[model samples]
Target: MTTGSATLSAATRRSVLLLSFATFASMAAQRICDAMLPELSRTFSVSLAQAAQVVSVFAVVYGLAQLFYGPLGDRRSKFGIVTFATLSCCAGSLMSAFAVSLDMLVLARVMVALGAAAIIPLSMAWIGDTVAYELRQETLARVGLGTTLGIVCGQLVGGLLSDTLGWRWAFGLMTLLFGVVGSLLFIDRRRQQAERLPTTNTEPVVRPGFVAQALIIITGPWSRIVLGVAFVEGAAGFGVLAIWASHLHQALGLSLSAAGAIVALFGLGGMLYMVVARQLIRRLGEQGLTLLGGSLMGLSALVLGFTPHWLLSLPACLLAGFGFFMFHNTMQTNATQMAPKARGTGVSLFASALFMGQSVGVLLAAGLVDRIGSGAVIALGGGVLVSIGIFFARALRRREELMRLQ
Candidate 1:
């Protein structure tokens, strides 16, 4: 558990950068639909609630598809699977751009989600294979620059493209990004294969059947805790975030682009964390970081819920972004170590739980927003997040104590 900067080797840094680009593409595609809800509703002549199906459906499929990718990543080459998945994402984004009907768009998004489900978790698994556990969180935060910027750009790009060129252009842009990243990864894979040499020092991967691996991970106490927490975190955090654009547009009377810009500040907060991640980790440690992140998120939610003017949302969004990554990166680090022997499967299941939680949260929020209003829904989510943060901090402290004794 050393605290100094963990210098990445040249090859590892290159691979991480490539993977980060792919992650950026995937995340951008994921959030593009958020800013398009109003346009989609108008274009399809559907209610706002119906338009939200675009996000929810993608999340549901994304969560389910993780199960398949997990075992595949464990058994096959993670980078190879990611390369193929990136290509598939290119196809999906292209399909989305040309979708003629709501159903077609939903179907296209499903494809996008299916492909995207593999990228981040598999990348994390690959990192776990190469990086030590003590330095994994710091590595993740550094590599996460792509993810944080993608989140920022996703909201901004989605809003800007949807406002200026139309929602189709957003997907079109994603299509181009996916194509370029996928091609680069494919070439990198070939080069790696050519250079790879067999070695006896490396242990052969003993991959169990899919069902057995799933059962093994699900039955483990630590895995179960991590998965459960991730599920709830997704439900509580992303569920409310999913509706930010719509809330700002409808409730605050802001333009779609304006709403997106405000929400995009969240990513800036995450970027702030990335810049000072090592310092924060050194100063706060896991438990302290968890508490601080949760508090910030709760404060942000309350501000968003109660603020009389829309102008105040900027700082709120920033706080939410910073807090979210602080809390989430910790969970992600734990996920990488949940089952080191089957790291891919473990991380995939962790992601699966998270996205599944998002789907459930969105569904529930959709039902509740109309009744209690978006502010109330957001406030409730914030409260839950605070509770989650506290619980996890205590849990991490106990785990650390147990490890010290061991």
Candidate 2:
């Protein structure tokens, strides 16, 4: 149980690689609807908010389902659960492709959410069980390259397919993606079992039921702060993000494909952060990351919201993406270390708070879009995120001092 990647086994590395791909597909499925929101609205003859149910409902189900997965991953094989979940997503994606009505599509999306719910957090917990804290952030960033890329790819593909082939084609792509990734993971699992490798490690379980484990996580003051910040991060960051493409499409008069491409830069920026994350983590420290990441994203978001010059969007979106990952990567590191005794429960609880906030944010933002307009809403989200950064930075300081006293 070395904590450093330098001593990490080859089998563990391979497992992490496969888990990364699974995460990519899971996240891509979640965001595939971003560019398709307008097209779905037009196709179904519904309002923007109604069309957004595809994203919001998925978040709702995705968040709540984490409760089931926390204990499950802790007890069983996390990788095994992830493999099954990835395969399950194919069924849902196929259903989404063939969805005959809006309700049907929402239901189909719920199916997808049920499966996707197990991927990212459990993968992180699995990593937490393996990688030591010294290099965990960098390793997670490497794995998160897939997640961040999925953000861009999902939007890019959704917009591109919706514009060219049709919206249905987007789901078709996800079906193919899930099937391929799941099969690969299944093969890897079999190989690991056959070889009797020790790469697939699990944490030593504490004697508690899921409810008690969850209570242990939620009752900690530091855990409460991480969960709280995560909730706001979900709402203000990812939740309000559902509208960016629509805003560019509607207000800026860009095509959905074009708008999604620009928004894809946000993920691209995130990828950039992932690429350089190790360096930044060494340089800035977590507090600096939180404060600066939030400021950069907030200012960049304001530019995207207010600037009539669409060209400015190129840099604004890129910087915004970079800044977001800076903060987000820091958050991920803290989450993994939050509850060592019940790492699975702690990380899953963090994920639950995040997407639940996303659910609430999407619902609230979508409603306000009609009244205050998308720009105002987006800018408002940016401002809130700045405050979040500041609050979390101070909290980090307080936590460090408390650790010293202890």
Of the candidates shown, which would achieve the greatest TM-score relative to the real structure? Answer: 2
Q: Which stretches of candidate 2 lie over 4 Å from their true place?
A: 1-7, 195-204, 400-406
- In order, what lDDT does every prediction score? 0.85, 0.89
Of candidate 1, the 10-residue stretch with the lowest lDDT total is 195-204
Q: lDDT tens digits, residues 111-209, model 2?
A: 999999999999998888778788788889988999989999999999999999999999998999999999999999898778765532344647699
| Residue 344 lDDT, candidate 2, scale 0-100 | 77
Model 1, 129-238: lDDT tens per residue? 77766678888887687788888889888888788889899899999999999999998888768876221113357778888888888886666778999999999987
Displacement of residue 338 (Cα, Å) in model 2 is 1.5
Error of 2 at 257 (Å): 0.6
Measured with C-alpha atoms, the lDDT of residue 157 in candidate 2 is 95
RMSD of 2: 1.9
RMSD of 1: 2.6
